[model samples]
Target: MTADLDHPRRGGLWHHPEFRRLWIGESISQFGSTISQLALPLVAILIVQASTFEVGLLVMFEMAAFLLVGLPAGAWVDRMRFRSVLILNDVLRALALASVPLAQWLGVLGMEQLYVVALLVGVCTVFFDVAYQSFLPQLVEREQLVEANAKLQASESVMQISGPSVGGLLIQVLTAPYAVLLDAFSFLWSASWVAAIRTRPAKPERRPDRNLRREIGEGLRFVVGNPLLRPIALCTGAANLFGSMATAVFYVLLARELSLSPGLIGLLGSTSAIGGLAGSFVARRFAERVGQGPAIWISSLAMAPFGFVAPFVQRDWTLALLAFAQGAMWLCVVVYNITQVSFRQGLCPPALLGRMNATMRFLVWGTMPVGGFLGGLLGSMIGVRQTLLVVAVGGALSFLPVFLSPLRRMRELPSYAATV
Candidate 1:
């Protein structure tokens, strides 16, 4: 059966059982993942005593899966049950993360193991994220896409607010390696919730002539050929590329150069989530007021400048400056994400949802590893602060693609058929 895309239920998404379950699981997973985000790099730096480039390499390994198997994974996912994929990936990630704590307890944890774990977890995450995005269109009506994404983004923001603080405290007590165990448990919890989802999406029809390469090409062509999607992809990819570069050594800058404590750094990270939470609340309204298309570019354009503030941060006001910059950056990011994601969900055909989402992710997120490597290289060459300045300037200009596209004229997005 097709989803009820045109008619939204009367009450908010909380009234829907399946969506609620998905939200809860995702919420728990997001919280745990946030902790790992801080804890993992800290493990490399503190426990293994990794250098600046090594830390960046850790980031690279974590996101490198997108560049490797991203295209084929999408074609593969299009032929499977999204919920099953989500559950399996969650379990795999949990297992991978659990290995870190086990190795640490045995006094055998090393940088190499960390790299392996990052790569494994990254591979699992790539699958989970693609399936997760594809699954959403089946879970909720298209009309509820914005509201649903907003609520989900809000939960993620809340996790961002609290997760790092908790992670920092755990690191103080249990140490960074042990702290990752919490994330492992969180993944299992997420898997259970996802498995419990009752509304199963009908499987896509398989054709006898199915070919992986052709399917992959179709996804790529659809994304690159579309007017709205093309610019969106370009804008997001460019933004993420430079954003990754700036953030590659951000913790290093804070902990080593700025000499900030983990607790203070966590606190500053939590402060940034405040803007994400606010943006979650405001994203739907902002889109309605400014028009969805305008909201996409305007939000990005407005927030891009705050990134420049990072290079100027000092010890005395480091907390304030970091919080301000991250807060402003997250605010726009959430709004843009909510608006754009909902549009894409509404635009793509159900048959192409998996491939479309995967292609979009591959295009947008694939730049992360490249940027991470560049960030590390630049940090080592010029200095962390200098790299931040360059990243900021480049990121600010990334919005030019969306601003110049036909998306600027339309108040609302059209479906794939209409666009053609």
Candidate 2:
């Protein structure tokens, strides 16, 4: 049975039947998402003629969902069946994305309409993300999580590398709204794919206290009280804050400061896929040798050095190489996430997974807007180079959470489960 199941299909999790289906669906969705990432901004720039402040406002609107919806939605998701939630999220996102193109075709595209779509889609994304993270542990055995996450990361990495290039092409060939149509299709595909996954029915428990404040508190307590989760949360949150800060100025670096064309930037960013793919492969080995905890620490520390190099690139080619390094740096993040997520999932009682996942993300992503706002502010005041240097310095400081926590000494994913 093991031999037949393990037959190398695509040289990794692609060989597994269930994982293959999930991967294909997710990949398609990612491609579409990539198109929208490019198309949406172009729509704002070319169609709406939005100003920098307007663009920043739009970004804030999009990200606001994470801050506003993540915790509550996570609490709700823990009490409900996750599969249906994921399916609904995809369906809703598809409809939301479709509205943009449809409205454009009807000659009624407006900033109001665009903002609404961004806001709604972001809300949907929060729910989908919370549900998806909680759902993974049920799909695979505890032992195979590293491989599973690696495959998932590889898929996302591929999309990250290729999605923008493809999106850019579609935008060039078919205008921004039409380019978004591709992503709408991808969401539909994800919805259908999610509907096909089969898992054992969860043993329903009494719904926790219905008071909104109490439920939210319960979720927060679960995350804050967990031995392993608390430190991971703090470390990841700080890292996310720093990364968001730097990303806020990346486009300015490419377009306004570096004087690079969109096509070149897209191509340069594409090279990051190789680094992600490489990092995914390396992750499994690292976990085996040093353990998930150490892997997380190493990956976290490595990211700071890699990020600092981008501002120093002197030439276009060098910039691209640095971008590849950045991609690899991000890949390390993916590996850390996979390991940590799996460990968390395996250790936590399934009943608490949703809230735990949500709580962690809420705290981590909650800082993103602050980071982005600071990024833009600092970039404007001090210059993009100085802003990034600051981000790098702050990002390096993020490792302090892990260093101070028990993760500093952890050698591997604990063989005997340690409850949160």
Candidate 3:
């Protein structure tokens, strides 16, 4: 039985039946999500005729769940069945997304409906993600995490690479509003596969002393009180904040100012996917050579200069600069995320996995909505190009937290990271 699992001494995750199920389910959903990431906004822009602020607000609504339920949701997920939570969210997201095209077909679709759908999706995502992270430890041995995460990220990379271009063309052919139906159906497919996963996650250890506030506080302290985890949170949080600022208006810039078609805009999205694919491909080897800790900070600074290249993009040959910058950023981030996520996952106690991941998500992804709003505000004030420059400048320094930490001096991180 052990020999058939994802043991390195065994055949790795490919031989792990349950992990393969999760991967196939997640990969298909990711492809759909990737396409919808482009299609949804295009629906807002082209069909709904949303303004810049409205578009940014759309982004905010999509991510607002992290701020609202990110903490307590983790605690709640800890108590629930992982399979139930996963399947429920997948179904809910499918229903919510399906509503988009239905409303359009009925000639009743509006920004209000879109915003509500985005919020519902965000809420489900918050729960699903927390449960998913915690569920992984039960699915495989501790040693298999990096390999598992890399494979998962690799599939995600492929989806991202192809999804945008395909989505862009689909948007043009089917019209953006109807294009969302693909993602709607994909969620159903994801749910079916998740229901088929045979690995039953044991019911969580029950504690009579469980309190939401106290549990949340415990998770917070575990992250914030630790030197290594603290810096990663800060670095990731900062990068996301500033990155969101530029991305808030990125579509607007491409569609409105640059006058690019949906197909072209989507092709540009491929730059990051290309980078992400490279990062996933080389992540394990790169960490081995450079040291896991070094990989984190080195990848961070290596892409710093790329941020400055984005705002300088032109309609001509310089388009490649934006692509390069986007790709470089994704490349670095994928490597950084794969390493750091494995580190943190391996670091926490099983009971704390949900909370630790939730706390981390709050710290990192919570900034996205705020940044989106800021990007919109700044775009109105400083113009889109200048706002991107600000994002670039601030993003260049996001690696400082990790760089200044003790991890900078270490070679590899042990699962049992003892540094305070």
lDDT of each: 0.89, 0.75, 0.88
Candidate 3, overall lDDT? 0.88
TM-score of 1: 0.96
Q: lDDT value for candidate 2? A: 0.75
Over 99-129, each residue of candidate 1 has an lDDT whose tens digit, in order, gives 9999988999998999899999999988998
lDDT of 2 by residue, 1-420 (tens): 244443535566556766666677777787788778767766776678665445545556666687988888877887778888888989999999999989999999988888888889889988988888777766655566667877888888888789878777777778888889889989998888888865534645765546656777888997798777888889988998887777666666765567665566566666766677677777878877887688777777777777778677765568766876777677778777767777777766776778877888889887776676777677767877888889888887887777677776788656324534
Backbone clashes for every candidate come to 0, 1, 0
Q: Candidate 1 clashing pairs?
A: none
Global Cα RMSD, each model: 2.0, 3.4, 1.9
For residues 81-129, write the lDDT of model 3, one tens digit per residue.
8878999999999999999999999999999998999899999999989
Q: Please give each candidate's TM-score.
A: 0.96, 0.89, 0.96
**Deviating ranges (above 4 Å) for candidate 2:** 1-16, 106-111, 200-203, 206-211, 312-315, 415-420
